[model samples]
Target chain A: MIKSLVSITGVALVCAALLAGVRYQTAPHIRANREAATWAVAFQLAGGPFPTNNVTLPLANLRIGGTRLDTVSTPGYGGSIEMLVALDRGSIGGVKVTRHEETPGLGDFIEGEWMNQFEQMQPMEVDTISGATITSLAIKRALQSHLRTALAETAPEGPPG
Target chain B: MTFRQAAIERNPAWVQLLGLCPLLAVSNSVVNALGLAFASTFVMAGSALIISLLRTLIPHDVRLPCFMMVIATFTTCAVMLLEAYTFDLYLSIALFVQIIVTNCMILGRLEAFAARQPPRAALADALGTSCGFAIALLVLGSVREIIGAGSLGAGLDSLFGPDAADWGIDFTDEGGGMLVALLPPGAFILAGLLLGLGRGIHEQRQARAHLRETEG
Candidate 1:
């Protein structure tokens, strides 16, 4: 009985030490990778004659050229869909699905040609993609709500128009 | 058994039917398949080594539980390392990653072979088994990805890095890839075909060997 207890404890302790060592080495790289991905997604939505030294705006928004880029998430058929919506002069410049959990073949069209409809239009004009109604609706609803909040927050700046 | 025999004649995936859940689920893409394969191999070999080292120290009554603890520890290490270094791939296979702890192949080997073998022999067996499993995953993943997307290596960038972004091949000029091949049923069909192929080859080899023996 005593030997069994001692052996179990020794093995558990060794395993814990090994895990701690690896966690220490990997934590920083993971953080940096996530940050880089977020930045890349934000810039890609902005669709620019590239901006030099794009300034960080308020409310998790980015200012690139004349466009303001922000990210939002909405519940979809499978899970949450995260999108980066770029606003140029109070109209939708472009919208990009940064991440999603819709059905891989059926509903993932939100990341494809279906999203092209949101380009250079008002958020209200966005339509649901055929056969992917739930995912498309999620993106549209999320974009409307986010646009409302963005507009309300920046109303004092004479609206991007 | 020799490594070649272990990998082919007694393959854990094809012949023994072990660890098929992740094999089918993540085999949609080569990168996902490779990621899971690497993790499984690491856990299998590490657990084999640790279990062999403690074979004598573990009491008979609690041996199974002890073996489980060792396998779980190695799996946790694999999970953390993947999450930290290959965050995208980790996210894609997170569900399958946790499932690896319960993969019968690891426990099966520990009970059937690792418990009785020396550390070196056990490690070699684990390596061979893992190689077999990896090969099966790669073959299934390639077939599925190519047919499903009309492309190969679509997500290599996630596994290798930015330099691999252009590695994907575009087979169709105007793309409308088959959607069914990316779904669950596709995995089932492809896996069954591969298993049948393995069995056919094995049977043919046996028949030829028997003929040679009878003539001799």
Candidate 2:
């Protein structure tokens, strides 16, 4: 019994060691690739017209990052919706209707291009999502609260909008 | 557990009730949940396969540390694959993807199923768990993607290839789309409704099965 156990344990160790080595070997490349992609998105979110390969700028004000807008819940035409606003500095960055729980065939465009109208629009210019009025109000109110909070808070030096 | 047993009978969500945070947090859309489910399954299966295969050699004194080392390695690989091939998905998932290393389901299956069973059985358990997980994720994704985006699998272009643009459906005419479904809070409520929906289906199936039994 002890011998069988030892053999099983030995096999386990050898297999794991081999797999671990493969993982470690490729770790650095994966890390670099992911970082590069994030930097690109940050610039895009910041409304940078040119691709600034430079990622981090600790010394500069208006660095780039995705600002998660105030999330709120409401009965949409489909179900529920989550509105995330990407902000650069105090200016509106970009708006992504991150998720929509509305009905698929009837009212799914809450996250589509039509919502782009609100991308850089001011807090007061909040528009309603057609076929999803309750969802629209909930989102607008949450965004207003976010804009209010952002105005109240000291702006972080992220990418300029 | 057997694949059938773990997947349907003793499901991690409906039955075992493990890993609910990541489950609920990531299950907002099919894309999000699918990304996470694949990552989680990879880690669980890879580690279990490695560990069970090596069950003969490791010293008992350092087994836990060894197990961790094995688990971490696979988790790192899962993250790397996402970063490489699915960079957008990787960014959307962000930290939650990394947190898979700490998910008890991986470790739990390692200890309970993998350690006690052979590599094949362990693989089966991992497959079962992931299948169960994928079902949950796909359900969530279908609900959120279809309802939130007004289409199913929108933005699958990036996932598929350049040619996929022709495949997506356009549902909006003007003043289209809801915002709440796309953001964070949507994740929470969307998942809740999906879970409720899953339960409702299960109950209906059970009721139908009972009716069939009575008639027979």
Candidate 3:
């Protein structure tokens, strides 16, 4: 009995040590990659070169050539959908679904060419796709909230003519 | 056993019918298939080596649970490594990777081969089994990706890197592609056809050998 206990404990300890070693070694690189990916996706949605160095919060206050870009997350059919919405003078410049977990074939229509419809429309007027209603609505709702926050932040400067 | 025998004649995927859940789930795309294959191979070989080395120390009653712990540890390591280096591919197949701990092929090898064999032989068996699994996944993934999407190597970029984004073939003009080929039924149908083809080839080889023996 004692032998069995000792052997099992030793093996478990060794396995734990190995796992910890790998996690420790890879944690830094993983964090760096994640940061780089966020910036890449943000830049893609922003459309062309932006002042990466000047941006305070890449996800919230992304400013590029008189346009403001903000990322928002909302629940989709499968999981949360992360969208990058570009705003220019109170109208949507462009909207891109940066990340989502919707069904591959069916719900993925939100990522299709049809998403161009969301561009140049007011957030409340954006229509959801037929089959992918939930995912589409998620993006719309996220945009609505982001627009509210963005407008309130710039509201102090008085209405731009 | 020889690598050839393990890979083909006594194949783990088709012949033994082991680890079919992952075999079917991730084989929808070549990149997903290759990612899972690499992760599984790493876990299988690592587990086999460690289990074989400690086989004598483990008590008979607790061996199964001990083997499982070892397999789970290796699987966790694979998941962490994949997440760190290949975040996109890791997200695509994270569920499958987590379930690798429960793969019967790994447990079966530990019980049937690893425990009784020396470390060197255990490593060879693990490699052979992994090769067989990888071959099966690649063949199924390629066939499904080509027929379903009307393109080959559609998502190679996810597995390789950004440079491979242009590596995918586009056949959008080929009559809109086959939706069924990318679904679950497609995996089942393709797997069945491949199994039949393998069996037919084996039978023909046996018949030729018999004919040569008679002529002699």
Candidate 4:
């Protein structure tokens, strides 16, 4: 039994040693990867391809210059999915799903080309992703807040378009 | 210990039912399920081998903790390897890969098999447990993926590299695929169906065996 204690302890020591050694080595790479992915997504969302310069989405660096959060939702297979879109300097700077209990695969309409549809569609136009009617409508309804905010910023006579 | 006994009797997911967390979570997609299954297999096998080899001297009092420590180590290594090499899968799987450390299957096998049996027996037990888990994951994954994504094993490039992009046969290629099945709710519904199906199969097999017994 004593021998067992010593043996197990030895294994513990080795594991701890490896953990101590490798965590530091991997952290930097993980951080970089996360940074790159975030920027790539943001760039794509900002109506541009990822830059070759490898710059991050400079949320902190860029002044807010004025921003508004608009709530949007569409019917999802699971339920209603509400999303919040951030308008910075009159452009769609950030978008996040606020309330979503969507079906795993079927309701993933928020991602991929489905989400991209929001870029071109008018807030009142209401674009739906074919089969994902509920999901797409939820997104459209959710965008009502953003539309309100847009209308508020631009008076009836002024063309923010 | 034959493979059959290990499967139906031991039944890692249902009978012993360890690792059900990941099984329940990732079983939404066959590819995700398979990725997890293979990684779990590697970790289980490695941990079992190491624990069994050192079982003789491990103090009874600390056996559980020591076993956990060993298993955690192998799981960590595999998790790191996956994240580093398989970035897309790593992205998709996210935290579930690390959560394998908490999987009762590996720990249960360690305590039950490695603590009591020889290294080879422990290995066999681990292999059996992994196989059963794999089978469960694959079935659930296939159902979910086929229903949700309209394709089985469609997103191969994310894991096996860009070359495997063509590996997945797309039903949507002809402009047809049920988009709803690809969401989270679809995963739950599909998994529930499979579980029910498994129960049905088990009941039929039992009824058949009972009939055979009567005839004999």
Looking at chain B only, the TM-scores across the models are: 0.96, 0.82, 0.95, 0.90
Tens-place lDDT digits, model 2, residues B32-138: 77788888888888888877877656556656766777787677677667766776777677557777877777788887778768899999998998788777667
Going through the candidates in order, their DockQ values are 0.42, 0.13, 0.59, 0.26
Poorly placed runs, candidate 2 (over 4 Å): A1-161, B58-64, B165-167, B174-178, B182-190, B200-216
What clash pairs does model 3 have? none
Candidate 1 achieves a global lDDT of 0.81
In model 1, chain B matches the true chain B with a TM-score of: 0.96
Return the TM-score for each candidate structure. 0.73, 0.58, 0.76, 0.65
> Which candidate comes out best when scored by DockQ?
3
- The 0-to-1 C-alpha lDDT of every candidate, in the order given, reads 0.81, 0.67, 0.85, 0.71
How many backbone collisions does model 4 have? Answer: 30
Write down the lDDT that model 3 would get.
0.85
Off by over 4 Å in 1: A48-161, B153-157, B161-171, B175-177
Q: Which run of 10 residues does model 4 chain B get worst, by summed lDDT? A: B173-182
Q: What is candidate 4's CA lDDT for residue B48?
A: 86
Please state the interface RMSD for every predicted structure, separated by commas.
Answer: 1.6, 4.9, 1.0, 2.6
For model 4, residues B156-215, the per-residue Cα lDDT tens digits are 888888898888766666643565565667656766676677778888999999999999
lDDT of 4 at A89: 53
